[model samples]
Target: MWLPLLVKRLNQVDMQKKGLQLTAEEIYDINNASLKDAIVQFGGFCTGEFISKEGLLLTNHHCGYDAIAARSTPQADYLTNGFWAASRDKELSNPGLFVDILVRMEDVTGKVLEGINAQTPEAERAKLVSERMKALAAEAKGPENYVTYVRDFFAGNEFYLFVYERYNDVRLVGTPPNAIGKFGGDTDNWMWPRQTGDFSMFRVYADANNKPAAYSPNNKPYQPKKHLPINIGGVEEGDFSMVFGFPGRTQRFMTSEGLKLAVETSNPARVKLRGKRLEILKADMDKSDAVRLKYASEYASVSNYWKYFQGQNAGVKRMKTVEGKVENEAKYNQWASADANRKAMYGNVLADINKGYADQKEYTLSQVYLGEAALAPAAAKFALNFVPLQKALKENKADDIKKATDAIKEASKEYFEGFNVPTDEKLFAAMYQMYYNDVPKSQHPDIFKTVETKYKGNWNKFAAEAYKKTFLTSPEKLNAFLAKPSLKTLENDLIFKTVNSVYNNYLTNINPKLQAARSSMDKATRLYIAGLREMQSDKVFYPDANSTLRLSYGSVKDYEPRDGVHYSYYTTAQGILEKEDPKDEEFIVPQKLIDLIKAKDFGRYADKNGELPVNFITDNDITGGNSGSPVINGRGELIGLAFDGNWEAMSGDLVYDKDYKRCINVDARYVLFVIDKFAGAGHLVNEMTLVTTPSPNASTASTSAEAAKADVLENVKPAVDSKTKVKIKKEERKAKAKMKK
Candidate 1:
């Protein structure tokens, strides 16, 4: 199970018993450099780790998909051909990409709850907590570009403060072509027995003092406090494995009613809407490479969760998770009834939670449809960006108008970069029709009335006319309008009016009731958790994930996913060959990689069986944001990158099933093999510290594996001096520039 680094010391005895070689202080220390220093929150959504002192980072290929796709073009299609920087100067800069390293975390529960009591109203309690959190964060702000924020834990029963140093000058180092990196595609995304080499490399650059700074040509590669040593010694069955990173969110405390709503109402609507959007985008993307590059990131983002919701619903039903929660609540109620004080405190917790969910159920599907359908169109969402500029223009405030206009211009760049006019128009028509058919008539936005009256309920005809007239679809048209600045033009714009009407209706009608229900549910959940903790004092309670740093430890082991259907712990190159199908894009293998596998070009990176390991599974508790997390061995060495979870445990975010929840990881050797052999990026490999020795406590080593260890050590090379190579590259670039002059 996952444990917060804040209280890891408290469980040191248990951790050691589970084969953790490192001390608690070695894992996380405020005054000294520890394992935490090497980990970073990649681009605010995923996790990455520093593998070299020169700040070379390693993360999942999908995590870096957007950055790589953003740099791709028709001629230099990095997404298909892959990218490898031959020298430091050749590395491409990603403008908005940043990585945050944890400096420390502090518990401030008492400070945050200083002026709060049980009698305090929910609204007042929230306001007080917000004010105190702001004050605490402001007090912790530093001159060295440190970011501090306080997050509530255990449903607001406790709070913790996190301080981080954010570096903005991250650059792409290397990546395998999608044929290898994304071999299995969506078909095999959350499945096991996989061989996808899902890894990408990047480097973080900082100012001369190694402090955070914006992008600059003169900035040097960051020197981190620590970097993980790479262990080429392959994993064995039952080997101790630990995954450390920032896991996004988990709803382990969700009541039975909440799960019912997600499974029955919210998830289905989202799946249907996204599935339609994906089909349209895919059809267009297949027509041309340029279109594919344009919508690749968008398609990947939508499809990732589209399949996740489907699996979650099925898994929840199969696992009977809702029924399990109901049973637990009954037990809790019985326990509460045994004591007078407990009865007074927790008697109505379950009832309040159930009632709150019931109250919100009527509006739940409406809210889902609104988000999934009404706001799904790109042009409609883009039009909302002009809201500030419209207000400014109405008031005739030049400064506000200028500020808002500049922001819109900046936002338009990214929007139009991935925007496809025909695709968006199709989405507009399909999404609205879905909304009209699904959402209740009384909950329909005012725009539907206009659709019926002006266009006779023909969403396609309405979308066509709207696209034709609105300036939001094209950058040139939007820029032309922005230059003149007409409030009347914006007020009459069809797309703007439609989005505003839908949003305004939501704000006016649906949000208040939802907020009231949420408030009641939150209070009851907090009380229930507090009571449960008190009752089960011996149980070690770990708070649910909230995009905060966490550590989950388990072992490398196989599973019987079903009776008489046992799966192995790891996969190899042979699996990739067996899965390859030239006709199917998902299984297509590059000829170069296929040849290497056929030739058995397995070097020291291979296992004792003379096979190159690809992906492995561990029962490490992880969820969405844990993607790209480092899978470290007991010796605190990098072994693999956690990329996806098994489909059998898709409901793990709500209820973790120890037997079914498996973390799928790309083996570290596979990542290295792709870089050094496949991509010819040996320089990048030369930047990492490679270790061939096995941990002393490793128990499952065979005589053949022990014999192969010596051969592996002989082939392993020491890391080159990255600082010297970088300095040389800089000098060479300057000389070449002078020669050109």
Candidate 2:
């Protein structure tokens, strides 16, 4: 059986138990309209779902952070106070944001595997597969707006083609204050028992005919074929749930040596480097509101992965991830040795992998340090721009120089907006020192020699002198220099010379060694993966995730992380107040939220216990690109938004541990509560079609009215106060009118 059949069986059992009464076709059917149409790739980076027929979309707050940051100012701190579009006309337009919806997918394995297989050389096989994919993709192309690409699966043993349509005009609808949406910040990120709302709302607009178009005032909200109906019924333990989205990557088939490199070197280096960088940025941000708003997105982006790396390394060691891979390798080797044909096909896989790691480790570490050190300094990074200017100056064309200079002038405003010279100087000194000490002397970049000779190995003095002399540090000075456009000045520039010295050495010395080692490792991996599939012929193996649309299913269940520590499946708003600290930037609780919680003003969004549910956890397998994926019950009704993974499962991207792996999701009720009660955006709520339950399966649902009423009654209702009761009644009446199809 294929992976789809296994998933179907899992869903079939789940639906029967949870009263969802849904079939596979309802979730993913090419012949009929299905729930798949409602899910779209948000901003080409995260997953999102359509909530309203008018294209009101829901995604995680962090997914929309960059756009929100772009629209933010100190005077109008949307990041801090929250934002609500009083009406569609008032919603802010996000210029570079867009959504992609998968039109369809088809297996192209037969076409991709036309050439000689076992006998063909690895390089030849790759070329043949690539050519076939390109040809198939070309044949599938239909319209200018639609995109097509082919993906490799099961280690190039399988291939599939996917077609998608793009929607460009996505606009901000509403968002909760950072204190609510990003409640626990880095401290609580990836840790369970969380209270973060972690949700955001946007709307997609199309042309008059409801076709994709550029942003225009006259565009209307996209009328989608299917939009998920919001189920007010909260989830319970062992309830059937599934997540459909684009998971970025998962190296499930990596060898032991690779895991060792990550645990020993890569993870620690990244965490240390980002820690210093974040400290520098946070200091400046705390001192000024202007700096805070300006660097908010950048700081968040850096810290998110910084913490992830730390947890990942710890998890790797705790779980003995490398040992597990070694065991798998041993099994593969045993299987290979038992048969002559198998041995011939995969004999040298393990030795080649080990050799590659041995050869590539030192260079890889050097490359990582170079990125964290030389590239970490703002002045050093900005200096690379002058290389293009230098090339243009050599051309001696007026237009070329003008174009290059104008580009630099245009980029200056944004470059300097969040930058603090003194903060970056400190970062430069620290990072430079770390780089010098971490990497072996032979692998050290040539610039370190200059530092040792000129400044007597004092990174602080070198940093001070470099910043004082670099024109790139000040936008005004850079802009002035750009006007004259002198090549001689650029050649003599200290920052440029320093960067070029390191960069040129990396290109000439370090990169060649890395490439040769990586090539050997890749070839061995490809062969090993193919051999593994052959050995496990009785079972169907799915491909590793590569930023393609995939469906994963599981249930909402609590997990025991360690000895005597059984974490619950969900967290409540009460936890927010419990974790509150005014002095801490991460756990600062908003007074409005605090007052509401204290007064028990849950309105009509509280659970049966009269408490507001904040976040929940599930076993639905997901990764980076699945950040804003909708967590749907078996009936395909949206119940929550997946935002993070538990700290115990940070190594999941490399190896999925079902026992410890859990996806953290923002409960749908909490998201709506923040939008209506907290942000006071009732009109936005009116746009969605909220249902007590998803339409039951046609085959299993009872025809009697009594049975339908009983099913609806089984789902808990949110408590309504006098004011909230009236508001909900008005919304119910409106929904009833809209349902008159």
Candidate 3:
């Protein structure tokens, strides 16, 4: 349902019919400042949009969760007590956090595929394409600081070149406390009727010339080419909505066998492994706030996907997605057999895919267990860092040894900061045992034999002894070894040996098989997709998301999750109060918010019913990296922030269920209310251009108090002075005049 921006121009007429006000050029013109200029790939994972010329950005609270948690501590406790920087100078800097603004994207498919034909071998074709792409990227990346890369689309059937300007000086502006930002916690995650105010604010800083720069005290806020005007007007049920962002990935083209493997083998294994890890982490976290602070981000991340896999399995079953894929494949086969040319190209595609998946099944599951279980413990994963160090030591290369040692020393500081030995030991015991029991005996690592013979098959006992003997769990010991620089010391370490053996076995035995199977599947899939496009020539084929900028347009709507229950399109503050629990941490509401709700201190942000809108649902197609994407109305104004999809559509990445695929967004009104009234960060609001037109859903109200409030709001001075407003209008007119020519 999501189309790459390149294809948006082709669908411009169709999009206009759906109520889009802006032209395709207006949305993505490289020559003039357009809507794309306002958007950024936040921290290389989520999406964010510029809300002010001074580079004030808006993204989901969860999207900024890790950066916020990293800065939090028991004393400052920014996580519990929200952060608000009253001025630019007061903002906190986040090292290594950066945002990339896409400068432009151009199709380079013909150039990339040059000199490669059907006669070319798969490996040779791939090599040629890689060489061409590298050359094209180098040419595109001139003397500027722009980062250029080529990404394949439609499963290598096409490619596009993306140019981005990355700014490393992004700062946290403001965020509501977890009680507000993560109000429902995991319980309400991916669920409907959510009241979580999930928005967070940040500001991008740059050098004096408004170019990307590293964090510096003297750096000023960036002046973006375009910023979205915030529309406070509430949405109606049927109003046009569009979500634009970098949607991470989707496997809509995945074969039935792939779906079966995911649902039955990979997902369940990951769920079980992460579930155990979470149990241990939560136990320790609950016992102490310090532990919770240390592991909060990790817990959130693990639990998010743990729940996602569960929902995805259930949704896949409920939607009968695998059966549907099988039915589609049957049709594809029938279509392919009708013509000799098609049969020659695609006759083997499905058979190859089925055999490839079957061949890789056990190896894929083994790899999953190897990753999720064998490397589940922080200590085991941390030990991987010393692999290069060991190799350098063996080679007797002092420069490589010194470089590796310095890197480990720096890495150990961060690792030890969050590493809890007791918790990691438990994780090691549980996860290793899971891997040993689940994986076949033939595939077992050499260390499992040691555990069975030396430790009498007692994983806990082996783990305790391993933790005691290994330097990985102790920074002091690690540093001591680094100072001494002994290959024998590292090679003999039990944890290092265990991690190395697991990796070595996989590298020697499993990876080659998996890669070979995957290569066959990849080639078949590319041909299958190309054939499908040819067969269904009348249908518009949108490529699956690959972390590229995309646009999905739809309308605000509601749905029935089941036979008798119909859900509303939007949630309100009243739902927040209804869900609040005095004892439960997840549902606890701040007394300030509770009092404000009870007092009905709703400002101009209130909807027609005099209730504060919390979150709304749209049919916009989205996926993982679409988090914090701006939900824009037909007029091209920011209406909300897209955060999560409905639970009934958890398998959306594999199959988009039109009826159940609802995009959950925190209402822009709620975001503003929390920022302006709750956090007292009106200056951030003043930075944005506020659109106050009444919504289509607004109804006449005759209350005297309402009239008084409206009058006061109208009389308030605009953020921009009258002269500046006139100047802006004149500049806008000049740009339009130039566009006309």
Candidate 4:
């Protein structure tokens, strides 16, 4: 191999610090069209580094974990301790995860510009392009959905089309159990001193035909052309670095209004909703050891963000509204004063974007709620039966009776598990009391009197009747009375439409009103965008990551917490002991791990600081999408896997705090320690051609089988597959748009 095992590739040096932020393509030497195939999206994840011949595909650990977690059984712990197959036969399969390979690039610029161009109105353009892109995607037939994107540039003046191939050859290879993977749990999720290894391993399986195929025992791992070698020299301040992964989400660039709303109402509402869900999550997780283990990731995932929102909300609250008049007057005066700037395509900029922002605001805010309150809350109902059904439909109310009966009959079959009787009874009683207390009797005289006369303010009796009326009611009585099967089926159903209906009603009515304030703010966003464009155009700032593949760089730096707050830069074998509090669930260390800590045999895996630690913290700017990303140095050497940021940096969800926000990564050294020292698997370690000559006196005894994986950026090369070259011969354009200077 031309690439050495340890030495940083000379070509991979810090290109940016040499005053080269622009790619050769930008200077017109490299055609953007030629690179189209290299840019692709997978499971909403953007991908790069086409032709991964190294058989080693790099993505976020969280990206692979979902697949592994889906296949995980209680008997085999995968996420915490780590997974190493004795051979290929033991590899687990999952559907959701896939390593997308960008195979070809197609520049359909002319086709894209056929009906829409600089002259096209943004509204009409959106409509035309939406249909056009779908049509383009439809005309495609292949192993994967062909990704097509319309790139708008130079203030939306230019547009281009990018197409890519997605590979479904992903398989779980190895992973540490939850203990090491999710060390800090919810408490340390978004904060620094972050100790977590949010990484999962998977191998890409290419079919016998050497293309993506359905899962099979016969499939082989798709080797990539290049796999990053490990570099544990440890990143220091001012060192060049880059990250490559499927970052899930980022809100870096937004209308100041959108940012405000995020930092304010939207984030808070989500936090409140999640807070409620967590309360239940905590209870359920606490009660059962199996469920706790089974749903560890789900719980920690939410907790990570619960802290994020708390910090985000704090950032939002800390930002007091400035004087609108003064701010606007100054902004307007500045814009008006810049005659030269206004003359350059400024005439129609305002009116041109007037409706688009209006069109995109709700959708922008809608993005925030898609998973949390909207889906997660629904998933949380332990069983369908737990759904709080409305009290018996009145005999006189035929519509209500039929509605209730129909819902129960539908849910009774295959939908709900048995209702949680105790939880339901207690919850419904509290809910009924809360409802009765909040609304006036005068508003609903009939119902109020019924509530008063029968239940007589006794929440228990009221709740019991409602619970019985829905799922608990005997089928014989229920069928006789309401044209339905015995509702006994609902006793097992955890989901209830009654609860869903109420929740939807609240989301529908309350959200629209709340959304208007956000919409109004989105309209004023032009001012913000314009202000930002003016301010930061000189810096090489990419669009706030949209769960796309991006590179964020910073160095290892530790901070002094509040006077009494305790923290360390590289947690040691000792951190395991510091976290030995028995009462605190977050601090529970396994006995074996505690023993390891007590023994203090870090071996060669220990940093010069001498500790084969479990996890380490850093200040790299990372977020959801950045999860499982390989933290690399300026030489593009892998150092650690960015798993979580510190709690203080949780505020980084919306705002990137250079000072306080740090990317929490599972140090390469620790990852190696766990693999070698704890697992004692030498086979996996022997696979990697050892590249590094660590200090002979260093702690090799503590070093684990994962040492080969540590600082893994140098020598690994993926096996390459030769395929047909994508052919796109551009025809000369006569009715073409003029190229901008």
Candidate 5:
């Protein structure tokens, strides 16, 4: 570990020793939900500089996919190997994707609190608050067109006004083929000592005058004033790194029950769904190169989530961190258990939310699995069915029927085309078997029957036949059979329409029943909350995330995954090489990377640790929105790209694990290697402004011995997972006050 493994505080992270002082302005700006477009977005994520002059923007590889997917055809397989324009003119245009620039921020806490207080009836209160906020946003105007969303927390205790400038000048720049962008596969996700190059490049295109623009071939790359320069000097133990991005989601403010639900119910359900998706996508991808290419991005997108869910599960289990969820729940229970009046108002609410979870618990989980498993194979058939549906709708035969048909028409174009029948069917069977064997037989009788009929009661039989007869083995026939104008889609035409019907039944019929259950549990929760609040009304509390700008800080850290499995804080060039398993398609590392390590060509970014890093750690609070953020040193130099977090901390999505969760990031050194060594784009590397270390001072005998010890103790992790020097329990430092302080 060339970087010092950071230790996270359950409450605070002290950084005074690092000369890490936040200006009063920076501290104020960081805490509020304001006009944060410069480096943060309302959605809780952002993009930042790598090479400021070259206009290079660094973000999560996955974050740019919409723009990437915008230009995708069934023919262009960009998501697999990724998109790279040989020249700027070749860049694909995506009009909708934009970078928001923060123009102004104001404290709207007073107004928001007033709005909340005026509303009664919880749901009505929520709606009223939303209406007032939207009216305010609609009234705003600025350099860029953007929407304003309101965030209310601590029961309307806090509010902040945000004004942003949206930049439509965004365009695809470069990305590694998925081979590099997604190396080390599922097993390595969310764990430390990772070797993925999870970086993607996008350019902000502006008009001749450098303002936002719609699609234009002549649009030039916008120049940014604060693009980060690479400090190739690299990272070492005891170094400081901070990430700036709109981390999309985090649950630093979840109730204990909410946290427990995430750990016990949500995570498992997500994992099951993702697993089903991967099972379907992998089979289809393997059947043909065309299918593989067409669905490459879609598949990769699903895989990212699949890996994430599993990683989150693993992260929690590895560190014995699940205790956080239970403890949090207990705290909530304690607070809510105090009185009668308070409990009556909230009792039903908590009961309702919880019962809602319990009711949909299985069905919601089933939906993700069922979506890909049962329906995707018959997609084209549904498409063909829609032609008749349109004709029927035109005839005005029946509004409800036409509505159903019209619904299928929209779904056919969106969801079905992205699927391959064989892959989907096979995936369905694997999951069906899991269901049949695992879930109680009473819950899903009809789907079980379909499974038995589709495969003749044999999971493999169904999978093999579905592959040979449906999507994978016969794509052309599927297209031909389903696309005929005269075709009337069968009720069994596995498509989004059918899935929608299931959803309607669930939502309209099933979900309501589930809601009723939640309503019941909510009775208990509300009662508890009410009682607790009155008893401790004088006590303070914080609100959960409201999709507003937030900041969480931790230090670079390493933690044990399992009893014997310890992951280091950072990975090195050696770690990447060690994980390369040629036989496994998912784990391949580039030969060029292997050569770079052997050659020791760190170029400008190797830290004093003397090893090129693959990924590093950070303590910045990030969630979904924080994807693709740059982890900068205290000097604001680019050092890493935030990617995944330790799986032990998955529950953090709903419960902040002060000690378990860590932000995983790719070291900037790998970004250079991918560009200079593998991509043969040394020009990009040359454009970067870099920092150099000052010469070391002469050391006396005792000082010399300590320096030597520091060198060895700091830089040990290489291609393999190795022990990296880490900071243990230490003193806390005060957050530096801004100028006013």
Candidate 6:
């Protein structure tokens, strides 16, 4: 298997084998903008694509969910029923939402490495690299409006400069209700055989001249350099698939000890802490619609990774990931010990990793608990923002006091709108108790001492008193204090004191030791990665993802996650009906959707079998930030949107499981059907450059690989009855055998 390229460019031969017909220059031509221009970092967290020449954008429903929730009211709940602009005038403007397109990339390794080598001290080397990077980035940025930055690759063994153009005037076009967009919710997030629509529509607006500018009524749809042609005709199993976007991060080179610590310690801590937090949030959300609306986005954001951590812990344990890493280290040690030069360069790498993790074990747990516990109470976190006010009042700087007062007053509206003091008070007590029990007593902050002495270890009473006394607990109380704006008032506040004590102790005591240990690990990991790269010089080494544009391609095929249990490559609308339960919030199907299914009203978007495809799976490597990425086929046509990954490979960020890691995507046809039929937004559909579905025999993995030509797959799966399950297992065995041959 070939390693993916660090840059967005692909190996032509490998791409051709995967059915990609586009040349490397065609995919990423700096002189003539190409496919890369259509892909953008969607609001810094997710990926999105331009699907029409008119700059109509498509991303995951979850990506735009916050904006939708923010704009919604009880009388007109866009998140509950869905939102579709009847005309351009009705489209919603999203402030602070922007898309960043990669303008160009240049390898700047030689310039960055000008004064550093194997012998340079790590600190000195870092200083020199930082100086060089700033100069290069500034020089490249020039007088242009583009954003430019330098990124290190291969554990800082190489560097590249990237330039980007940002468009801020993005607007909401349409979305399906949460019932469809987040069908299975937390229950089916990382799990496969999904039936979620998981898509939303937006458009980029530009000034009359077609350049990025602030939102204005005069702004028109920006014409894009290139936009993907949406293929309503679906994909088949073994078809070529390519995912293009900014994958967040992958730690494929983590040491055995490092993997062990995350599996046993860190991941469990996050899962436990977040579980308690979600429990409190969910209970309140269930009771009131206003509370639900206020905490919807925050809950989704927290629970998404809360479940991921649970799956990752189970996956790593099941796969014996640490054991495999231990075996790999043993092999590397043998190779290192054989030569004196290799021994000097690489012998201590494993030991350093072991020691580093061991030294930071307690600190790592405390860090996670502190962040989750101390910050769990929204008012406590919000109170820290007034520190500047404290400083200003102490110094008697009237100007600074006025500025901080105004800032806090303005911010307090948004803060208190979503905040519920009673809910947070419960979370405050529960999380504090969990943290105190989990983390050793020596690591506890001074606040814990106060809890013991002042409240006699009665955390509920302590939390209640804290909430009652702090002016920050309510907008009314906080606003009254804002009118006076004095340092003495804030300094006497218990919330302010509690935040300071925990934060100051962590900074003064825990952080320095943790940083020192982590620094040693960083140095050891870099040297180990460099040694490994040299040992396998002929093997291709793709850099770890660092929120940069990258292209990964693979065949779309089914996998048997375990014996006698096989999942197919795709899911259909029928699956939704099968899973629907009126009593269950996660699986509730809208009556309109059920009627559409009953009428079989899929129109041209339906597959040959006359059913609407919902989600499909692929082997392309992806992570958190890759959500909403375009899942294009061989001819660079948009067939689906990459949204989630199968649960069996939740440890993928740390270890790439080629066989079990599947990129789950919502089929492009389903997106079209929802916009055209469900939302009655044909105008939005009209803007897209829709293409005819391909001939049934156009391509497959075997033919594409044989012909040296592919990008991805479309296969219909049989129903999961007892007999069909047996057949799937038999076919999976045959497929595995064929691969070996």
Global CA lDDT computed for model 6: 0.84
User: Which tens-of-lDDT digit does each residue in 106-166 have in candidate 5?
Assistant: 5566665463442256667556666777766666554346545555544454455666655
Task: Report the C-alpha lDDT of model 3 over 525-629, residue by residue, as the tens digit.
Answer: 899999999989988888889888889999999787875345668877877787788788888899999988888787989886688999999999999999999
TM-score of 4: 0.68
| lDDT tens digits by residue: candidate 6, 107-126 | 89999998678899999988
The predictions' CA RMSDs to the true structure, in order, are 10.5, 8.1, 9.4, 13.9, 7.8, 4.1
- Give the alpha carbon lDDT tens digit for every residue of 371-426 in model 4: 44333432223223233333443233557656666775665432223223444355
- What TM-score would candidate 6 get against the native? 0.93
* lDDT accuracy of residue 647 in candidate 5: 61
**TM-scores vs. true structure, each candidate:** 0.94, 0.89, 0.93, 0.68, 0.75, 0.93
What's the C-alpha lDDT at position 568 in model 6? 72
Lowest lDDT 10-mer window, candidate 3? Answer: 717-726
Against the true structure, candidate 2 has what lDDT?
0.81
Give stretches of model 6 more than 4 Å off: 1-10, 695-741
Per-model lDDT: 0.87, 0.81, 0.87, 0.49, 0.57, 0.84
Q: Note the residue pairs that clash in candidate 3.
A: none
Model 1, position 128, has a per-residue lDDT of 94
Q: Assess the local accuracy of residue 225 in candidate 4 as a C-alpha lDDT between 0 and 100.
A: 38
Q: Which pairs, if any, clash in model 2?
A: none
| 1-741: candidate 2 lDDT, tens digit per residue | 023323565445645565545776777666677888898999888999999999999999999898887788988888988899998899899977999987788878888887556778878877888898998888888756478898887667678898888999999988888988888888788887788989889999999988889999999999888999888766677777788888888888888998888788888889988998898888888998887887798889889999999888888888888998889899999998998987887888888988998898888768887787778877777676666777889989888888888777776666786677887788778887888888788977678888899889999998888788878778678867886878888877777887888788889999999988987787688888888878888755667888888777778888777753446677777777777889887788989889989888988778755788888898888899998999988777888999999888999888888799999999988988888888889888888988765323322334575344434433422222211111223343343344443
